[model samples]
Target: MADEINRAPAKVQSALLEAMQERQITIGDTTFKLEEPFLVMATQNPVEQEGTYPLPEAQLDRFLMHVLVDYPDADAEHSILRIVRHEQRAKQQSAPVAQSLVTQAQIFAARQEVLDLHMETVVENYIVELVMATRNPKAVDPELADWLEYGASPRGTIALDICARSHAYLQGKAFVTPDDVQAVAFDALRHRLVLSFEAEAAGVTTDDVIERLLSRVATV
Candidate 1:
């Protein structure tokens, strides 16, 4: 992947994909059947162009989420500042916020509950329509048809469904909601958009594409 990214040329990318397919190179191990749903989480710095190969659209589509890490919030920043000040005041002082609230067992239980969240057929169709609209915006809202370069993949639908359940579990709900879908949409669909060169040149981003998709694709 790194080598192909450095090459950047379309031909190089095509050749690399072909080689992987021919060799059946598992980018990573699959614990289940080939048809089973799988999710891959990858990280890349959008600002860094040095030595890093930008992921191709096809490769990016394989990822289930593209989370962008931000800096600490105001409260966290204040706490960090207090720690630093205290450290400077007394060398013996240690940093604060050293407490573990949830155990590994608790997290495992939470995941189980998330899996048990009910997904009605209506909600399932809603998820599908939302993802489908990304590919063919004209079907949902004609105004968005010209803004998109390419739509998301089927993997996106799976990601949305799974993450929605996870969100509902966190919220102590036994059922998924439209809000749950919205909550996870950005992370699930951001990387799947294949923006046109014009969109890129215009400073449009994946987030913009996702927002448009959400507006055009309605819930049940």
Candidate 2:
């Protein structure tokens, strides 16, 4: 279900990622298919990078997103403590089965609804332009010329479109907008970019460049 991939060696990581992409594993004489709704959520501990090998760009592209999470705030921490204490106290009594918010069938159906959500022509163009800018940042923003070594692949373009649709669905909206695209651009594109030495020497992050691109890319 979940793997702490940082503990694995480079060869292991490559094999695991290959499985994630193909949704199947092959042995000497036979192959097996992964079950439906099969998802592999991988995370690495942020503390150290001692013996682990970093994933390459091609392998990273197989993932749909790369979200960054931070420590919970005081309120959240307090809530977590309360939940733990409550769970401990409740162990003496029989607990009912937890209800799922949405089922697999519902999710499959919702995927269609999300696809049906209207995206105007201009907004679709905006999504393309945003990814296109990554390839030729200097054309729109001169400063970005020295910041990037290479741009995202065509996978980034498709990611921007579907992710925006999902964002709109989460918002209870029936349409997609530039704002929806903007909401997901960072997570969808951050891992796909390769920055240059000039950008690294100045402590520039992919987020910084993406933020600038979002601001400068034209919507109309």
Instruction: Please tell me which predicted candidate would have the highest TM-score against the true structure.
Output: 2
Task: Give one digit per residue, the lDDT tens place, for model 1 in 1-220.
Answer: 2422443656655645544334332444532233212223334554456655676777666555777778899999999999898778765565555688887777778767888889898889989999888888888777567667788888888889988998888788889998899999999998887777877778888898788777777787
lDDT of 2 by residue, 106-217 (tens): 8789888999999999999999999899999999899998999998888899889999999999999989999999999999999889999999999999999999999899
Q: What lDDT does model 1 reach?
A: 0.74
Candidate 1 regions off by >4 Å? 1-42, 81-108
Error of 1 at 6 (Å): 11
Q: What's the C-alpha lDDT at position 66 in model 2?
A: 84
Which candidate leads in lDDT? 2
TM-score list, all predictions:
0.67, 0.89
- Model 2: how far is 214 from its true place, Å? 0.6
TM-score of the candidate numbered 1? 0.67
The C-alpha stretches of model 2 lying farther than 4 A from their native spots are 47-49, 88-101
